[model samples]
Target: MKVDYIIVGLGLAGLAFSRELEKENKSFIVFENKSQHSSKVAGGMYNPIILKRFTPVWDAENQLKIAIPFYKNMELLLGNKYDYKVDVYRLFTSIEEQNNWFAACDNPTLSSYMVPKVITDKFNGIDALFGYGKVTHTGRIDTNKLIEDYHFYLEKSNKILYQDFEYNRIDFNENKIQYKNIETSKIVFCEGFGIKKNPFFKELPMQEAKGELITIHAPELDIDFVLKSSVFIMPLGNQLFKVGATFNWKDKTSIPSKEGKEELLTKLKSILNVPFEVVEHVAGIRPTVKDRRPLVGLHKEYKNIALLNGLGTRGVMIAPTVAKELYNHIENDMLLRNEISIKRFENN
Candidate 1:
């Protein structure tokens, strides 16, 4: 069979790219192994603030404007509710942090997202002595729901192959690619950390990190907004909260380690002054980069092979715009920005 593109992996990256192809009425097929947990088990929150330093994330406004409507349109396509507009309450660890919030609020770049007034009373069973900063225009996409429903949509259209893609099987020609019985004009890899196994693109630097999250039944800590401190306690409704996540750079395996769970509990307990029972624990490798920018663009030698990855911890905010960028680069011969283009690492 012949198609315009063959996408590997159906995580946020692949889904976002597929949407672009759908918009352009391009013929494509996607291969997903369902092995990566980063998207399905993600906290799925998209906030403009770094929270660690009370500064806006890079290109926050542009990404938000593109991602919000992109996912909302998906809601219309799938007839499932996954997009949510919720406020994020960032707890102040010290009085100095409170002052920093005010300083950030005064900055022109952050004024639009930073709530001027500090919220001292948003939820009970939480320790917020210095008060909290309310982040506006922030929310989450039920990533699990989005993945499952989007995959179903693709399957309904006969556009998905539910299997692990073997890189060795692909035969690259001058202007096309072939895999098994399939032929395509181009192939895009959105494999997340799994890209490490792809011989063609493994040379790119991928500073991956393992992250773990825990789900707990904390009836006493019922809240509407996401609570942020050392760890994020996001309400998943039904008296359940998804508190996570512990970042470990050493371990790259997907297995949920005991050390990770204990670390998360320690951090969660630091801010949440409520008792909770652990219900589940999940882990995945974030396909992060050294520069903390996304990895996008075509391979230097193989023009038909491309990549859309390195979304790191902010995949929900970064994927849509980056996907659009990749699509334009391929279909319109548009040059990718230096920071995000894979060519940045060509010498290394």
Candidate 2:
């Protein structure tokens, strides 16, 4: 079987790239090893606000503009409802922090989302902090639904190969790449943290981290928006909420651990005043890079080979724009941004 592009990994990056290729009416095939991974387990929150310092996220405006439309178009194309643009209520922690936020609201960047007064009595079951403010233009994608729909779409199109991609099976040539008995003009690796084994791009700075999340049935918590303090509490419908996740930079394993569970339970006890039942637990490694940016470009020595990984923890927000940019660079003679290009580490 021959195709214009062969994408490895069926995560957000791979799916986003495939969607772009489909838009351009190009041919491609995708491969996936696992049935579920990081993308499926993600809460899919696209927030413009960074809660730590209460600052705006990187390239928030451009990324949001590109992502919202892309996901909406994908929803239309798939004939399914998946993406939703909603407002986020950021619950304040302390009086000092609340004052700081109100003061910062005058800044040009935050004026659109910040409110003057704090909200005190909107929620139930927990002692109110200073107050809560809203972050406008926040949205979320139904990642599991999107992945399932795309998988079915790929199967219907006969463009997916389900198997573990062994590194040794791939044979690289000057103008093409081959794996097993299949060959393609170009091969793009979107293997997420699995890229650590790719001989061509292993030298790239990858700060792989494992994240764990737990699901609980909290009937008393009727909040519709995401709540954050030490850990985020995101509603998952049916009186269920997802409270997670612990970030372990040292351990990159995908296996769920007892320590993670205990830590989450401790955090949950501190935030919630209602009765809940523990339901599910999940763990996955994020393909984070050192500079906290995606790595997208052709191999320095291999022209027909490219990489589209390192989306980090923000894969939900970053994948669409990066995939579009990568598609253009691959199909056209365009150059990738120097900050994200693999060329940055060529001499290292």
Candidate 3:
């Protein structure tokens, strides 16, 4: 079959690009093998402020401006409650940390999201001696729900093929590429950790980090906002909280390990004083880059082959903006930014 494009993967990156294609009335088919876990098992939190160093995320404002409306429109189409607006409270451990919190609020970029005052209110299960710093305009998108519903939509529309896409099978014609029986003008690889298997773009510098999260049933810990300490505690409703994310550079696999679970529980116990049981444990490899920028652009040798990946830990926030950039770069002949463009690694 002939099509405008063939998207290999259905994660956040692939989904965002598909929307871009749909907006332009472009015909495309997506191939999926369910090999990636990062998008499916993501924490799905979209916080502009990087709590680790209390700095503004790179292009946070612009990303949110496009992302918020993008997901809202998806909800209207799919008729599912996926985007949730939740507040994030960064718990302070020491007086010095509290001072840093207030100091960060003075940043012009950070001032919009950072609340100057420390939240001194008591929480039942959390131990906050120095209070918490609240960050506004933050929320979580249920990525799992979004993926499932979107796949259903794609299936209903007969736009997605549920199978592994073999790169070696691709036959480049004069203007189009043929993969098995299908021919397309372009093929964009949105593969997450699966990019390693891609011969065309696998040589690009990519550092994969395996992250694990646990869902706990904490009935006593009543909190409305997402709590960030050593680990993040995100409220998942029905007396459940999704706490994550241990970044392991050593472990490349997506299987949840005992060591990973122990590490989370140890950190969880330090900040939380309530009794809780682990209901679910999941692991996924985040497609991270050394420079912490997304991988977007077409292959240097093959113009029709493109990529959208390495979104790191903030895939939910970065996907829509980068996808739009990639689409415009390819279709409109617009130049890609040097940082995210694959040209940066061509010299390597």
TM-score of each: 0.98, 0.96, 0.99
Q: Which lDDT tens digits does candidate 3 get at residues 1-348? A: 989999999999999999999999999999999988899999999999999889999989999999999999899999999899999999998899889998999999999899999889999998788999999999999999999999999999899999999989999998899999998999999999899999998988998899999999999998989999899999999999999999999988889999999999999999989999999999999999999999999998898999999999899999999999999999999999998898999988
Model 1 Cα lDDT, one tens digit per residue, 228-339? 8888988888998898888898998999999999999888888778789999999998999988999999988888999999999999999999999999999999989999
lDDT value, residue 193 of candidate 2: 88
Cα miss at 42, model 3 (Å)? Answer: 0.5
lDDT of each: 0.91, 0.84, 0.94
Error of 3 at 297 (Å): 0.5
Off by over 4 Å in 3: none
The local distance difference test score of model 3 is: 0.94
lDDT of 2 by residue, 73-93 (tens): 888888998876666766687
Candidate 2, which ten residues in sequence have the lowest lDDT sum?
121-130
**Which is the leading candidate under lDDT?**
3
User: Could you tell me how far off, in angstroms, the CA of residue 212 lies in candidate 3 after the best superposition?
Assistant: 0.1
Report model 1's TM-score to 2 decimal places. 0.98
User: Of 2 and 3, which scores higher on TM-score?
Assistant: 3
- What are the clashing pairs of model 2? none
Model 2 residue 105 distance off true place after TM-score fit, in angstroms: 1.5
